[model samples]
Target: MTVIVRDLRTEDRDDAERFARSRHRALPHLLWTAEGTLHLLAHTPPAARRRALVAEADGEVIGTAQVDLVHDSPEPGQGCFTVYVAPERARRGAGTALVRACEEHLAAHGATKLFAWVLDAPAHRAFAERHGYRAARHAHFLRLDLTAATLPPLQPAPPGVQLRPAAGFADDPRPLFALDLETAADEPSDVESGSAGYQEWAASTWEHPMLDRELSMVALVDGVPAAFSLAHTDGRGRYATAMTGTARAFRGRGLAKLTKNASLHRARAAGVTEALTGNDGGNGPMLAVNSWLGYEIVATEVRYVRELG
Candidate 1:
């Protein structure tokens, strides 16, 4: 039985479903759906040269890879390829084949540095090290059982601030875009970030099929978005905190917590059964916020870096 790696067929629904399921098994922290997987393939920035790949042996898909360049970063030539093989098929060289294929494709596209998210497990770390990757910053995968978790009681909006659904900005989402970009610029990360493209933001964010505007909540001060909790739902009771941040000027006022709490309550009201979010392990403030909101760490992953000359 030989395992071969190949590009994933974008139009094939079964392949996408299987890929998502395999990822779910490999890393339960992520909330991925077939549609979401397809969207990444269709919507990733062109400079990224992103591609989804599947590794098969005996006609069964056993591994998956999401390879792409970091197009949004100010620094160029940074790429990423996260490879995962189903536990049932490990040691079959499926992971190796997938990583090799991804690296070759990315290098062909002029990528100089590569990053991968590896689960914080001994074998996972060893695999990355064997491939010339070194562990960088760590991140936590948090989960909340909305069905049984005791969330903090919804608090009244502060004076001069109003809690509003993201739908309020449907006619014009530029405000949300501006708020997002500001928060992203201040976000904690190894790589410097910027978010200036309104058109790209619309295409990659506002118009995305998985984003749930109704469940998303924003804290408005004088009718302007000051902080927000971006929401994404998988059409299944699975809700994710895509982003929760406050504008720089709004920091230290508890607006982020306020907005996120509102979004969580709205998610529960909308029948979302599970709430999932991720935070950089170094981001103590946000982690504290999540803890106060009843989230518990479920899994952890470390970012691995590799430099190519």
Candidate 2:
């Protein structure tokens, strides 16, 4: 059987569903949906030069890749591609074909450095090394059984504080945008990503289909948005915390835990059965908060880097 790589058909719903299915099978810890897939394709900034790729074998998609340049980063010539093949279809040449296509696309766009997140399994790590990539930072995917875990009881807000849902900001989401920008700038990563403009953030994050506005909890300190937990639900009983952080000034008050715990509790009440999140291995504070929330590490992935000649 011949495996061929091609660009994903953005206008085709069937194509998007197939792509999302392959990705979900390869990485089960994260949430994926066809609508979310299309949102990324349509909402990504033009400068990103994002390309959605798929590997077809016997008239079916067996692997997928999201390739793009780091447009918001201050540094130039940096790009990334995350490629994954369905677990049941491994070693069928689909993965290698998709990787070659991803590299060609990024390099053509002036990428001097390329990075990828490879699963920490032995075979996955060996595949990255064979492709001339070296492992760098590690991260973990954490899971919580929302339906079975004993969640902490909800508590009243502390003095001068209030817990609100992100949906309350629909009339004007600029405050959430500002908070997200500040926290994202401080997130640990191998590549330094700069902040996105309000318009960009709205399109790529706030307005995305998967963002669960009602379930995402935000903390208000004297009416100012200080901390928030961004939630994404797949409409299939699966929910993930896209990001959870507190403003710099509110760091020591345990607001991060406060917001996330509220979000998870509401998510369970809303019929969400599983909760997922990811954290950089070096981010001890967030990791600790997840631990307090009863999250357990389910899988790990390492960021691999490759430099072009």
Best by TM-score: 2
Report the lDDT tens digits of candidate 2 across residue range 193-250: 7788899899999998999999999999999999999999999999999999999999
Cα-based lDDT at residue 278, candidate 1: 97
lDDT of each: 0.88, 0.94
Alpha carbon lDDT at 248, candidate 2: 99
Cα miss at 206, model 2 (Å)? Answer: 0.9
For model 2, state the Cα shift of residue 224 in Å: 0.7
Against the true structure, whose lDDT is highest?
2
**Residue 211 CA error for candidate 2 (Å)?**
0.8
Candidate 2 pairs with clashing backbones: none
Backbone clash pairs in model 1 (N, Cα, C under 3 Å; residues 3+ apart or in different chains), count: 0
Task: Return the lDDT, model 1, position 120.
Answer: 91
